[model samples]
Target: MSSTTQKCADMLCHRNGVLKCSRCKGADPETFYCSPECQKSDWRWHKKFCGKQAYVFDVELLGSSNPKITRKVAVPSWYTFKQFHFVLQYIFGPWQNCHLHTFSFLKELGNQRIRSDFSIRKEILLELCHEGDVEYVSQNWFDEREVKLSDVYEEDGRLRSKIMVNGNFAPLLYEYDFGDGWEHKITFVKSELARAARPLVKEAVGCGPVEDSGGIQGWNKVKEAFAATQPTTEQLERRQWAREVSGLEERYNPLAEPDVIVMNYEGRWENHEEGYREDERRRTAF
Candidate 1:
């Protein structure tokens, strides 16, 4: 038989028809889930990208028993719900139209945002104006001469790049430092990002910025998944309080003096104090 559908859908991967899957046959399907456990574990996010297209085993569809495998399997970058949500909307939306140029990876190119956890906060981001030296960026070249016209090196402020695209963080050239673990880079890009690579970017269009309505249901599912990641402060504190109350119940003593009991309860809510300044261990940072 000819060999066409015997490989996984991921072109970079070479799974030798070993990664058994129940939902789909042949190579990796649209979701590329290796097993049912994986599909269910990440169903919220996976359903979004998998779309509704049925996966036809490469060799089977081609009427071949085994084809020369030449697929490139790609690993996803974002891992958490928060990251998945942001990528689907921001990075994937407009940037989806542009070619994804991943610069960092232990192995593999054309991949970035590993496990997909990324976000942009306006609370700390410094904003810039339009009419700046943005024309140079559109030319697909980092021209120092053109950059001099704008005060891009002030260090105290940010450049006005993607501020127009991202409504909240607007203007891309702004930078941020998440922590010691992250690489601080500029965000947003108004003018042309890759002039020479325009064709590649065009081909990459419609890959990200998933509207709430789109996705084979993967988009909305991811939104729900992102929201489900963390328990609210009230929820956690309430649970903690319940355990504390149970412990106190076990330590109950009917012989304790009323005054002592009253004093203990009086100082219990010191957690909500906002205008007090004394003591090394009784302070809450938030």
Candidate 2:
């Protein structure tokens, strides 16, 4: 009944809670979820920091021809997965909203993958494994929107008694711009029991490729084109367009200073900003 749990965790959603974060209730009785649908939808990023003091995650951009792109971030436990996605997008730049993405959990034993559906209106599809074989278990998957990091993470051996104290759990996969096959591997580095006002970038390495520059192969091509001496007219034009799309004007040299981290997270909540701007525009129009 705390003020924090009085409403759903989703800012866009205003549902009063009948459902709460079961894992968080043991410590903080807040963090209630409106419904299973909301939990499933928000699971990816929320699971990183929910009900904990703080969480450190190591993120690496996958499928890039170059393997140097990576980032380390510290986030407040209460942030939703949707919020986390924006953080990744800012560091990697595409900066613009122009891609489809999904968060997936994969296991190596039998190559099983549990993915969260963007639309959580339907029943969740769970994967059951036995002796390296996998099968789909109906009605067993918890909606991602309703789940939080506290739900999946266990520090005191309460959730998984058999899990060793030092064992590392499965990593999460964040696949952005599916067409470009941009994948990121997220590993839980550590967690603390203190609260954070907001997420922060702890470290950053290597600059990501231009937005929608194909996949690994294409990224390599763009790099080569930029590095070419006496480049062709076509390559020059391509670079110009890339600079605009990437928002990197004179600082577009990847080889010179590629390890910088850009923090522009406010852009993610632009829809909220647009409304106010539009309202002011209407008032000024007359």
- Most TM-score-accurate candidate: 2
Candidate number with greatest lDDT:
2
lDDT of 2 by residue, 1-286 (tens): 3344477765667987556556555343435567888877766646655555767889887654454778887765555554566556655644343454555444321222223332331222221211111123333333333444554554542222221234556556666665676768888888764223455667777667777788767777777778889889978876777777677786686544343433424343355335434643664486
Q: Scored by Cα lDDT, where does model 1 land?
A: 0.25
What are the per-residue Cα lDDT tens digits for candidate 1 across 155-219?
22134332223333322221111111112132222221111100111111112212222322332
Candidate 2 displacement at residue 68 in angstroms: 1.0
Worst 10 residues of 2 by lDDT: 125-134
Model 2 CA lDDT for position 55: 74
Q: Cα miss at 80, model 2 (Å)?
A: 1.9
- Alpha carbon lDDT at 89, candidate 1: 20
Q: Estimate the TM-score for candidate 1.
A: 0.17
